[model samples]
Target: MANPSHDRDPGLVLGFERTVGDEVQAVARSAGLVVDVVLWMLRRGGWSVGIGCGAVDEPMPASPREAAGPAFVLAREAVEAAKSRQRMVPLAVRGSDEGAALDAEAVLMLVAATGARRSAAGWEAVDAVEEAGGTRQEDVAARLGISQQAVSQRLRTALYDETRAATRAATHLLTTAHP
Candidate 1:
């Protein structure tokens, strides 16, 4: 949804349901999609995101306009929390008896660091490294027809290593999470 106050800024709202004792591997898989979407949105300069996971009291309406439920409430709360913290994304997950809220601070920092249009080339350089299946920097440089030193500079400029580490941590938490 586009922010009402600022037409240029957009917000994303996501919700899902989970059962007790349900493994979060699927959630982890979905996080990859989230990561991609966040990256794409951030590149375009609007990355306000909110995610909610819980059971809804009301049935889903044919149109989203009529949708109202606990999940929606949680999502709104998450968005508010993000706004309060000046963070890009916030996630709230509710299980049968447990709930968790996370600020996604690390990923937001990574996004903020690379949000400028000037960083697009560095993002492409990072993508090249990732697409090569974590190949050596020299290999990435060769493939991109750039000097290794140039590739290194781009990687550093993009905070590639720190971003990768943060992503890994997110995946780990999601995969091992109880809720």
Candidate 2:
């Protein structure tokens, strides 16, 4: 489901709901939505995510599972690839443009790997900034009960800006390869 929603990019997830057991099905029409979904799954952990970008039949279906097209077929294949053994990154992207798909996957994996190495305190600082919606560092420091310098240090060490840039790149790549 579209759980753990965020306001940092509300438009990325304006109206999404998922109701499934042991799994969830979703469709993202834009690059931002795709990246938002990927971030959500990564944060929750324990998900083998597949992002399929391509053409779907006209007239959207009631449910994602009921939808059909190259996108669906690519997504199935991507999921299988994600679940493969020795997969360092638990996500995959398959699209009409093979080059873009590979680029998107590489960039997303970098973001994921960087996130995985963040410490609890680092996440605390990062989340404070993200939740505040372009808030000042001092504000984040006050919220986290840490010194402003500490907040800066944490964000720096976390490579928050770098990761954010990487995420944006991934979104663009996905959009090109899929849409």
Q: RMSD in angstroms, candidate 2?
A: 3.3
Best candidate per TM-score, number? 2
**Inter-residue clash pairs, candidate 2:** none
For model 2, state the Cα shift of residue 6 in Å: 11
Model 2 scores worst on lDDT over the 10 consecutive residues at 6-15
lDDT of 2 by residue, 60-167 (tens): 776666777898789888877887846656888899999999899999988887888899998888888988989999988998888999999999999999999998
Put down candidate 1 lDDT per residue, 63-172, tens digits, no spaces.
33445665556556644554466444332332222322343434444544544533777877887887788799999999999999999999898777777777666544
Q: What is the TM-score (0 to 1) of candidate 1?
A: 0.57
Q: What are the TM-scores, per candidate, against the unseen true structure? A: 0.57, 0.88
For all predictions, the C-alpha RMSD in Å is 9.5, 3.3
lDDT of 1 at 147: 95
CA shift of 23, model 1, Å: 29
